[model samples]
Target: MNILNTIRERRSIHTFKDQEVNTELLEEIFTYGSYAPTHYMTEPWKIKIYQEGGKTAFVDAILASYQRIGMLKMDGSPKSVKMNDSMKKFLLEIPHHAVIYFEKKEDLIRYEEEYASVCAFIQNVQLAGWEHGVGMLWTITPYMHDPQFLKDIGLNNEKVKIAAVMQLGYPDRVPKDKGRSPIQDKLEIITD
Candidate 1:
């Protein structure tokens, strides 16, 4: 697919088919993602993929984070218990999870630049994945902010910044486009 069409048609897919996307294919897509612009060639993004049996530990950490933050309350109430169980099952069913992160830069300006570069890399991953009939949901959930969750995933919270945890697989359903406002609404031109 052409870049323009790919950009327009790509969607954030939540539901995925019960299939495992090939590892080699995912590598190729990420290779394309690497072409995204990096400030001073720092190439700040890093990824940790969890799939199959590996997802169990990741899901556990997420649930633990939710409980720690009080977003999930399994207070012996039947409703809360059911909700927790349901969420666990739903997360475990996803075919793959990619945790994207980058080392923390101490300088304020450098940190912003690195963060922006990683964001561009993420967009590239989504676009490249779309061309291969794969779908990705770039999620910035509350669990991502939990220090314990980062430690559970074997990342040092003090040393790295999590950008997103991408849920990836072949789409079971694609949401309809919620069209965007015209560029003119947000754009400002200055010619002096």
Candidate 2:
């Protein structure tokens, strides 16, 4: 598929079919992601993939974080229990999750540059995966900000920043395209 068409057609996939994506295919897609532009040639991105039985611990840590932050109730009431159960089930069903992060830089400008580079890398991964019949949902949930959650997931929060948690798999369903506004409105011509 052409780049323009891939950009226009690719949608964030929420539901995934119950199937395992091959590791080699995932690596190939990430290799494409590595081609993203970076400042000073610092490819500042790292990914920890979780799938199958591995997802349980990650999901538990997320639930713990949610409860710690008061986003989820831990009173053990039927309603809260049901909600947690449903959330666990939904998360577990996704075939893969990639926790993308990068080491923190002390310099403010350098930090921003690294973050921007990682963002570009993530977009490349998404686009490349879409072309191969895979879909990804780039999520930035509140739990990602929790220090304890980071520790549980084996990342040192003080030393690294989580760029995103990408949920990936063969899509169960693709959402309809919601058209974007004309770029002319946002674009500006500056001629001095």
Candidate 3:
């Protein structure tokens, strides 16, 4: 498929099929992500791939971290759950999870640049997945950004930050294209 078509057709899929994704396909996706342009060639981004039992481990860890933060309930109570039941419903449903992280730069000006690189990496992964008939969803939840949880996940807290948790799998349902706004209205040209 053409790159532009893939980008336009790709959607954030929440429902995934049970079919297992082969390692070779995953390698291809990661390779695409690795090629995203990075500032200063730092290549600060890192992706932690979780599949099979690993996904379960990740979900559990995230839930546990949320429970520690007390965001599960407004008021502490026995019935208060860290993660809503519905949210948990989808957390364990995906076939794979890729936790994206980026090493922090001491220079504050470069932080946003590194983040933009990570975002590009995410787009590359999603595009690659679409080309390969796979599905993907990028999520940035409070649990993913928690300091302790980040540390527990082996992300370098001193030098890195959790960017997002991306779910991947075969789609259970293919959604129709949701058209985008015209680019002409959104763009501004300056020639001086």
Candidate 4:
């Protein structure tokens, strides 16, 4: 498939089937992501992939954080847990979860550059997955920044920041294209 066509058709997949994503396909996606360019030789991106039985830690940590911060109000309503558990249930439905992060650096400019590189890397992964008929949704839940939650996910570093949590799987349904603003509105040409 042409790259432009993929970009035009790819949509954020929120729901997925019960099938698991192919391991070899995921490896290929990551391999392509690793080729994303960085300003310097420093590779600042880190990813922790969770799938199958490995998803427990990530889900538990997120639920715990939500409960900790009173995001899930247990006011004796029997259906409250049902409502609050939707996110958890949806997470379980997906075949894979990828935690993306950027390592911190002392230099401000270098830190920004590293983060930009990681962002580009994420875009590459998404595009590559779409080419394979897989889809990914990138999110940054409040729990990602919680120290206890991070520790539960085996990340105890004060120097690393969670950039996103990407959910990946074959889409149960593909969303229709949502048009964006005209390029002319955001673009500018200047030559002096």
Candidate 5:
């Protein structure tokens, strides 16, 4: 598929079939992902993949972290209990998870650039996965700052930043495309 078409068609998939993503296919996607530009040609990202039974520890840590931070609670609060249960179910269904980490840099500018590069790398992974009919959901949120979660992912260090938590698999269903706003309105041209 053409890049533009892939970009347009690619959607963040939440529902996935109970199937393991092939190791070779994962390699193929990341190989393409490595093509994303990096600062000073320094590939500052590291990927930690969890699959099969390995994902259990990672999932447990994330759920525990959420509970520790009050984002999830089993304190008999109806709303909290419901949300926690739902989130656990959603997380458990994903058979593969890759946590991308950005190695810290001494220079602030380089650090920022590395972060941007990693973000692009992540998008590259998603697009590349799309070509193989794989689904990816890019997530970074409520659990990102959790120390235990960081430790669980083997990134418990001041020098490393959690770039993204990618949920990977074969899609059971593709969501309808929610079109984007016209770029013309958001563009600002300055010629001085």
Candidate 6:
């Protein structure tokens, strides 16, 4: 598929089928992610791919971490939880989960650069998935930022930070295209 067409067709899908994503396709997506631009050639992005049995374990760990942090309220509680049982259930059923991390650079500017690079990387992955008829959802639940969980994921607090958690799978339903704002409204031309 053409890049522009993929970008236009891609949608944020929260629901997915039970079918597993092809391993080669997943690798190709990651390869695209790894090619995102970065300052000083410091490729800081890291991704942990979880699928099949690993997906269950990853979802359980996420829920457990949220519970440990008091983010999940008991049933019928007044303080509505941001991540409810339904969301957790959906996560557990997904065919794949990718945890994206960025290693922090010493310089502040470098840190920002790394983050921008990671964002570009994610965009690349999303577009790549769209071309393959797959759907990808980027999430950053509070549990993902938990210190203990970060440590468990082998992310160094001193040097790396969790950027996003991307859910990947074939969509159960293809959504209609959503319109976007006119580029002219946001674009500007400078003259000296």
TM-score on alpha carbons, each prediction = 0.97, 0.98, 0.88, 0.93, 0.92, 0.87
Off by over 4 Å in 1: none
Q: How many clashing residue pairs, candidate 3?
A: 1
Instruction: For candidate 4, write residues 10-128 as lDDT tens digits.
Output: 89998888888888989999878888898876767889889999887778788888877778766658787786678688677788999999887888888889988998899889999
Tens-digit lDDT string for candidate 3 (57-137): 677777777777876653544455433555566777788888888878787779999999999989898999889989988
| True-vs-predicted CA distance for residue 155, candidate 1, Å | 0.8
lDDT digits (tens) for residues 1-192 of candidate 5: 999999999999888899998899999999889999986898877898888888777888888898898878868789877887788777878979899998888888988999999999999999999999999999988788777778776777576889889999999999999999999999999999
Clashing pairs in 6: none
lDDT for residue 184 in candidate 4, whole number 0-100: 100
Against the true structure, candidate 1 reaches a TM-score of 0.97
Error of 2 at 62 (Å): 0.5
lDDT of each: 0.95, 0.96, 0.82, 0.85, 0.88, 0.82
Off by over 4 Å in 5: 76-86
Of 1 and 3, which scores higher on lDDT?
1
Instruction: Give model 3 RMSD, 1 decimal.
Output: 2.5
Error of 6 at 114 (Å): 0.8
Over 18-76, each residue of candidate 6 has an lDDT whose tens digit, in order, gives 89888999999888877888777877788898887776667767776777798775565
Candidate 3, residue 132: the lDDT equals: 93
RMSD each, Å: 0.9, 0.7, 2.5, 1.5, 1.9, 3.0
lDDT (Cα) of model 5:
0.88
- lDDT for 185 in candidate 4 is 100
Ranking by TM-score: 2, 1, 4, 5, 3, 6
